[model samples]
Target: MSTLLPISAKTPAGRPRGDGAETAQGLTPAQMARRMAGLEGLVWLDSSRPGEGALSMLTALPCEVLAGRMDTDWQRVEEELEAGQKAGLAGGLFGWAGFDGRFVLGVFPHALVYDHDRRCWFDSGGLAARIPAVAAAAAGSVPRLDFSPQVRREDFLSQVRRAQELIAAGDIYQVNLAHSWQAAWPRGADALSAYQRLRRVSPAPHAAFLDLAGVTVLSASPELFLKMSGREIMTRPIKGTRPRFPGDPARDAASLSALLASEKERAELLMITDLERNDLGRVCEYGSVRVDGLWEVESFAQVFHLVSTVGGLLRPEVSHAAAFRACFPGGSITGAPKKRAMEIIQELEAAPRGLYTGAVGYFGFDGESRWSIAIRTAVREGERVTFHAGSGIVADSVPELEWEETLHKAAGLLAAWSLPR
Candidate 1:
């Protein structure tokens, strides 16, 4: 644990603060990670407190890479990792994982960790000592980005009607239907600047920005998929949503109130909570899985959400990999009666979700992990940038209202990039 002392020397009027006193070049940790070599990375936990937020930048990779395309490969990695005589690995591993990737891509990086309380950088390795003299990455003026839908509005509405019919037939209680909106990636689009704008416009606790290879993931998600510390595993699933209007406190409060009071929304949330509890039960000790909170209304930059926390103690025989596999592609996004809902979603949704509904976070070597449901995210590859948003459709859901909800959820991101809704 090597700590860098805070630079407190004050500067003259209008001058920049001394090193260590100033925050890193307004770069979203992921942008900072990309400048480094090997498998270096960053994990930033969106927090409200100015200095209390968690941010980690990895500057060194322990090895090249270890990617697995299937569950068995990951399971084998878990077994081999646990069997390794690496003592501090108990702290965990650091990297990223996705919901639809054929492979779970990851790496072990030496990191520089910082938070508000600490107020200084702590490096697990000597990497941070060599801070670079890089110019501030400029995003210039925010440009309006327009999006085209993969699934037409009428088509999405028809899909919603079909889902309701399925519910009527007792095939499933609810299903999540989504549409991908795509736009041409602006030439030299600075994802870091986009993320900063996103934070300013729609800050969220689970916001993340990652540039894995050339595929950049920009997220301002307000939902937590899973978090584990030692034997305790926790998940906060978000199911219901209502958008917040800019500068309209009265309307926002009413929206929040409506979301909380709606029986349909409550029912939707409870169904997912039950699904999560069951998911946790698969890897947790018998009778240990429980719903810690139900139907809690959390307000965010863009919307109000009905969130619930489900937690459990991991069975001694269950590895973290097992627990994650059993619970992921989180039930909230997939809907109730998970497998059947997914089948319906696949059949109806125009395309595979790819990385949109994935999970992103670091699994520390200390047996601690935190990942967010990759909602409210943008994926940029080459000349294209795409975003996806969806709403859970229940028997009582109106197709038009559900379609509008997706727009509401995407409003902040669109606004951050100056895109039309």
Candidate 2:
């Protein structure tokens, strides 16, 4: 929507081959595997030609689905659908698209859609049996890394102070702060292997490295941006953050617990809850907006987080894109008074935030979905890889500690590149 780069795994044809390796060409993975095989992993589907959805290219296959009709309000369409199931969503999207439209959708079941208990995935490429085929192509190829680093730390802080001054004058309650990172790489080694390497050295339950258009968003985040079901919209914005135990268990616990009890953290969390509720209220049924849950803690390999879940029923008039537009680039990742915080972030954080602080997930027709904020992550392009991480800054925020928090946040990706997590 911002005239940004494409967000799909499929490589475009006629686009000059960097390597002679034949880029796989056909209908998307799901369309090709219409029968006998099950689709899996973070299935991503988008158009080579922008804006329009794929029609005849898909729907040639049979499946269950849910979707957000471009013309229909999202709340009305996805009344009770799971956020990730793509079959139903594919059907819904194509069904709404009718006979001729260029809209191409992606269907992803799960990494373990075929076998959830086992950590292994069913690579349609026969990654198990024919690993050599795809593996052989691995050479000097690379992946592009992207981010929005904090521009001038002091200048950014000055903007935060300005916001605080405005707050003192009574403009708003809070604002979110952030930084970004980005890089690009050529494909060589296996992406899965890289991920496995990370798991081996630094185990994490919620880390992910999703690729779209050769741009991989590698992350080790414990934060869930939002999940939707039927009329219920649930978003858990992680507010306060603290790194994993750095030798001193007592200090780590104290740090986490202090965040739990800190007035600044509590206020920060509340502002997001309010922002989320308002965002949901846009598409939700008039009376459906409500905070079903409150402040709670979710633990991860590197940090502990303060989170809260809020839910609401969608009104019949909202469309899926409408819902996204109502809440794009997550408020928690941004700041309160969302727009203003974003403006300040652009000025403070040096680089442009490609997809670092952005949300990633599957948009389906079945009405079900789950998206996570890309934090604790790294980006890789060619031989170069980098990680981006940052913390919120309020009048009470300590710059030194905030800087430490960013390093802590970046630990996972940095670790991927043989650096710190």
In the order shown, what is each candidate's alpha-carbon RMSD? 5.5, 11.4
For 30-54, candidate 1 gives per-residue lDDT tens digits of 4444444223333334442132445
Please list the C-alpha lDDT of all candidates, in the order they appear: 0.70, 0.50
Model 1 has how many clashing residue pairs? 13
Q: Model 2, range 1-421, lDDT digits (tens) per residue?
A: 1111121121222233222112223223322222212212222221211122211111122133343333444443344233433323222222212111111223322111121232112222112221111323222212223433445566555655665675566555565555544444434545544544454445433444444323444555566676665555777788888777868889888978887788888888888889988888878888788887677886666677788888888776665645654676677877777777777666555566555665555444445445666666565555555556667766677666676676677665545544222
Which candidate achieves the best lDDT against the true structure?
1
Error of 2 at 279 (Å): 0.8
Q: Give the TM-score of candidate 2.
A: 0.66
In candidate 1, position 415 carries an lDDT of: 78
Structural similarity to truth (TM-score) of each candidate: 0.85, 0.66
> How big is the positional error of residue 266 in model 2, measured in Å on the Cα after superposition?
1.1
